[model samples]
Target: MTLQIDGLTKRFGGQAVVDGLSIDIAEAEFFAIVGASGCGKSTLLRLIAGLETADAGSIRLHGEPVSGPGLHVPPEGRGFGVVFQSYALWPHLDVRGNVAFPIETAGASRNDAARAADRHLATVALQPFATRRPAELSGGQRQRVALARCLAQGARTILMDEPLANLDPHLRGAMERELLAFHAASGATTLYITHDQREAMAVADRMAVMSAGRFLQVGTPQEIYERPASEEIARFIGQGVVLPVEIAQGTALIAGQRVFLRVLNGAETGPRSAMLRPSDITATDPGAEGAVAGRTLSVLYRGGLWEALVAVEGLAEPLPVHLNRPARAGEAIGLRLTGGWLLPEAAMAAKAPRRAAASAP
Candidate 1:
């Protein structure tokens, strides 16, 4: 399914929960929607699922117009398999009964539905738990059941809303691999939504970063992380600093220091902002190129990556250096800014209920 959303908006009592929003998902693409809570990620999903009415805008599936009262397709008719954060399974139904439910609803005969359910159970490695109800299954087991049910729906497009939220850290990783395997074999267009960056980076073919109620940026995971479209995006992707800068001839002034830039593209101006990610800064000795002397405030060993807070109060902003090698806290150090890219405020979209940006932080 090539899903397209254009200018979708929903308002209640003059408050727009989901403001103007649009996205294009390619066929067989594993697209991801990420943002913070209340950025309307789930609401956008519901609109796609036909669970709520859009106050304005249009949704098209495979280029077919869908929206408005009479024209909207119901969830059951959409050929979508959805697995939610809670794994919404029937407590009364055993695993086989649960997986067969969707097939049964579509007019499959009892024997046919049971066979289909069995096949899907095998696919998700849940055949042994065929007789287990929701309560009898673990979190990951129940999630597999939900996914199996979705597959049995004869669905060509899959939508998941925080499907990994309930799983423990180890289980989350396991499910991610399973999802990719499923997508590779089935080639269904998937739209996975979540607020976790690690999850998004792991599973997404491309990440759409949202803020407020609007999409701030959309690109490959590398593009979103490495060459972010704006300062806000850079901040969201890496631990960094966005400081006010004085732009003059071929150089920008940070604090009282003249820092040169390798400008890629931007507007000419007096005052602008420069974004520097922590990873771009490295500890170097005095007299090294681009080195600035400073005192170390603190050090942290984060997931085997060392980080130092270098205090250069003259720079107005405390710079964070992400060490490529480990170092101790309170150790005097000199650091150099590799200097990140430049972005203008105008380049940033107005903060709408960004379903993607909600996951920015």
Candidate 2:
């Protein structure tokens, strides 16, 4: 392993924000850690970078202990490049100076640092703006400068904390491409933290879903999206909505109607819940056999597709469905289920108390 974190723990205000968190990242791997806000993802990154000390556990890089009992390496000494959400560029310095500062600070001559910075800037396609200061550059340009600076430092491990969060949506795609290219060229072990699941899925070779300071599941983006470990993970990742149903002979009874679909995970015949993505559902002809009936509550235009909220009888929550054809509110629609991930009875029951408590006034 290139990076190993064991039994890591961090607390704030007497509460365990990062409780016993641990992860292993291989060398030259692009790994993303994704979760909602205040899930201790950023704090975990800070702990790994040595910006903040770990209350317990240890961090190892290349089999060398960096944070542990009586041994804490300074952030600068850890040889890890960090890209922050704010870009963190030097205001007074031009692009080249901002990129070269880290190198020069690490005992390199000014000329050598400038030469190395130029090469890195060209790699990021920012060589033309070398003489411009951070104030003169656009948000995306400044981000590239920050990335170039990290590359100039020659760190094999790159840590980014929502680096594209500050950029406009249109500019995020370009930066993501550059990041992928940079990783391919440098082969750095990157640990990226983001609340955006789409962004993480677009870039990471593997990602972990985190909640309340613990990883709920770790796997490829497809695996996590297709077969979430639990209902919370499915909802968090926007994979789909979990629907309560009765299963018997591999068929789920929805809205007093039996619909046949493949149920991922080892689910037996009983009362349970299953997560079905919007795409897995299709609108069929009225009164179609093996179809679950629902009324369209609303239809929303989502770029290339129309998204509709379906209200089915015998179900409390509305089902979200993405449609290729147009849909009208209050229209009768028959939903055909093609795929779903089943959650065992115990897991569904476990989530009931939490949901009840949350909805209580």
Candidate 3:
């Protein structure tokens, strides 16, 4: 393992922000931790970077202990690079100086440090801005400079905490691509923290969904999207509706219609909760067999296609569907559910009482 954390915990004001988390990251892998605000994702990153001490447990890099019982290594001694949302560049220094400062501090001559800085700047395609001050560069360009500095430091691992959160939507997309290229060029293990699930899915080799100081689930992006471990995870990772379903003989019964059910983690025959994504349901002819009748409750045009929420009989929440044409409010439509994932029995049990109370009146 390139990075290993075991039973790590951190607390503030008698509240545990990070609670007994453990994960192993392979060399040169891009691992992402995603969660809502105050879920302790950032604090986890800080612990790994040595910015904050662990109240309990151990942190290791390449079989060496960096943080543990009665042992704490400073951030500068960890040989790991950290990039924050603020970029953390020096205001008085130009781009080249910012990248070369770490090398100079490590006992490199000025000429050697400048040459190494230029090489890393070229790697991020920021050589043109080498003479510009941090304040003079755009947000995206400054982020690239930070990445270049990481490369110049010869860091074997990098920790990023919402590094692109300050950028506009359009620029964020562009910088995401730049980050992938930087990771490939540097060949360093990366631990990224983000609130945006979309960004995490786009860049991660594998991701963990965190909540309330613990990891709910960890897997590839597709696995997390297709086979969420709980109702909360399904609702948080993407746009979806979880409906009560009855399963028998490998099929699901929802709204008086039989649909194919992909059993992910539960018994094949029983009452369960089914998570239905937009891709699982499709518009069909109203009179088609096995099609459920519904009313369009709302619609929004999303670029080339239309998105709608459909209210089906016997279901509590409206199901989201993608349409090739416009749909109006209160219009009648037929939907065929081709596929869905069944939630495990534990998740259903955990949520049943709250749902029963909510629907009581």
Candidate 4:
């Protein structure tokens, strides 16, 4: 492992923001930590970068202790590169100068540093903008410069904190590609933090879903999406609906129809929650096997496909479905569940108190 954290915890005013977190990140692997705002992801990054002192935990990088009890290394001494959301370029220096500055600080001669900077800038395809100052470059270009500076520093580990948050949607897509290219070229261990689950899915080899100072689950994007560990994670990672259901003998009883259930998390015969994604349910012929009658509660055209919510008898919430054509409100429809995951019994039990509290009044 290139980075290993154990028992990591940080607090503010008696509230734990990062509570007993542990993860092993392999060298040159891209790992993403995704969660909503105030989930302690950024603070976790700062701890790894040595910008914030961990109240309790051990941070080991390639067998060296950077952070632990009675030991702390400053950010500069860690030799890791950090990219912030704002890009953090020096206004006074041109692109080439900005990239060269780190090398010069590491004891390279001025002329030697400039030559090395040009080589690094070429890696990011920004050699042509070497003379442009930070103010003269677009947001994307400035971001490349930051990356080039990281290359010039020869950093083997890079930490990025929502680096694309400042860009527009279009640029964000472009930068996502650019970031993958940069990672391939650098081969550095990357720990990326983002609130955007889609972006994390796009760039990460693996991702962790965090909430309220703890990691709820961590796995490949597909694994997390298709087989979420809990109801909270199922709703957070992607579009889906969790409806109450009864399970028996590897099948689920939903809306007066029996459908094969993809049992996950060792859910047994009992009342549980079924997680159905838009793709899991499809329009089928009326009275087909495992088909359930429903009504279109609402529909919206999403470019190429129509997204609709369907209310089925005996189901509490509407299940989301996709259609090839327009759907009308209150129109009768037939839907079949081709596949769905069952939430574990423990997760269903854990949710009972909250559900009870909300219905108490």
Candidate 5:
């Protein structure tokens, strides 16, 4: 299944929810849409699912136009299945019955539906609990059953809307892997939505970071991480800090000196903000190349990392540097700021309205 959104706009009372959103989703690829709540991420999914209407613009499923008042395709007719955050399984139905429901609705024989249900349940590793009702299943088990049912429904495309939201941290991680495995095995064109940066980065083949209703940036995980288009994109992706650093030509003005750093964008000279990733900052000897000395103000363990708050000269406040090597608090150390880019703040702010839209039901 492939999806194409061309100027797809959804509005409520004259406010655009999806704005002029255009995206092309390829068949057998996992595409993730990420955004904060109230940013219309879920509404976009609903629009694609035919659960809601777009006030303007177009949505194409395999290149067929979709929208308008009476000309509508319900969820079932869209050839898609959804795995919601709540699982949405019938409490009174057993696992087998729940998984077989869609097939039964399509007029499959009793034995055939049961056989298909059992097969799909096995795919999700939940066949052992076929007779168990949703009330008797664990959270992760119920989620797997939901996935089983989605697969059994013969959906060409799967829309997973934050399906891992209700799981615990450990379960979230486990389920993330399971979803990837399931997607890999099924080779279904999957579109997933999430607010979790790490989750989007970890699983998606490619993802679009959104804010207000607009896509901040769309690229591979590495492209979005190593070279973000703006400060907001950098911050949303959760990397090093973006500081207000002045730029001159190809060099940045810091510590009262023009220091050279990498520039992904060819902008030279003028006021700008440079993005510094946590892992990019390093502790080095005084004579080491590009070293900037600073006094450590604080130190904290970050998993396998050691983060320290250090005061570098020529900066108003202390700059937070992430060091892999352990450092003592209050220790005088030489710091180096390397591997970041100076970006225009205004460029990112301009993308907001083009992204946000009206509310969805």
Candidate 6:
């Protein structure tokens, strides 16, 4: 029950949008592909769903070829479900009608399709809105309707293309929980695509970070956050300050402080970047040895903590420091880095790698 994509490529106007990508998604695994907008995440999903033809490569499900050079499986014939960002419900259809459409399309009788729709509606807690039209429902309810319609189809693999993007912040949070519960109950292999790193972190069992039509790294959310493969990945995945450093013997001098490395990108080292998350840095006494001192530029209250911008020497940008207590602007403070990741030069290459690294970030 694995989905294997080999040499999957797509292009438009002679420019490659998805370039020679390969990945294996395991059965019932919640895998997410995350990147900035226009990184081709949605395009890849469209290619898999057969909405767009691939210029090259093949896609296999459970060892059966569905897409390749010549063979083409229509979206419905592939026995998969897709939930898009727009909710894509028929304007004239009520909730039950929308949910039953897929089942009915698969050759089920009207009564049987209605029954299956009822079951799926209950799974997503949308049974209460069974008679409401798409226009009559709230954004969250509309999203649930779309999801319920997909579930009613009973596809083993579910592809969601930023389905939560249309919801407000609070509704998005609620939907994320419902989505996870549905995935657990359905036992379906889910491929979620999003530009929101927080959404990817929340929903994925594993995630891939993409840029410029290629995956930079793939790993569990925690693994990617804790030990990013490169400075670019670290910056993309979360809030962090990538600082230049000098390394030797599993140690590095970052911001003038020598700290132990939890992970190193490779053996070769001279000048490299260290990922120092705001959580990894702490305020210290002024003039402390091996500590970097800087003037406070700004202090922002982030609900639970205050994030201060500190100006450090030998750095082109201001360093971000998360503080337990608020500090005044124009004040001075020293910073001590608890620990950090040592990114090798290759991981920092300007171009995508020719081969996937054997590490996760």
**Number of backbone-clashing residue pairs for each candidate, in the order shown:** 17, 0, 0, 0, 11, 0
lDDT string for model 2 (148-209, tens) is: 99898888899999999998999998888888988887778899999999999889888888
RMSD (Cα, Å) of candidate 3? Answer: 6.3
Model 6, residue 223: what's the lDDT? 85
| Candidate 5 global Cα RMSD | 4.4
CA lDDT of each prediction against the hidden true structure:
0.77, 0.84, 0.88, 0.87, 0.79, 0.84
Model 6 per-residue lDDT tens digits across residues 67-183: 999988888788788998998999898999999998898899999999999999998888889989999999988988888887888788999999998889988888899899888
- So what's the TM-score on candidate 5? 0.87
| Candidate 4 colliding pairs | none
Native-to-model Cα distance after best TM-score fit, residue 147 in candidate 3, in Å: 0.6
Q: Is candidate 5 or 6 superior in lDDT? A: 6
Q: Is candidate 4 or candidate 6 better by TM-score?
A: 4
On the 0 to 100 scale, the lDDT of residue 164 in model 4 is 95
In candidate 4 the C-alpha lDDT for residue 302 amounts to: 85
Question: TM-score of predicted model 6?
Answer: 0.91
Give the number of the best model, judged by TM-score.
Answer: 3
Ten-residue region with minimum lDDT total, candidate 3: 352-361
Q: Lowest summed-lDDT stretch of 10 residues in model 6?
A: 352-361
Candidate 3: residue 235 lDDT (0-100): 96
Clashing pairs in 6: none
lDDT of 5 by residue, 75-105 (tens): 7678888989999999999999999999999
Clashes of 5: 11
lDDT, candidate 1, equals 0.77
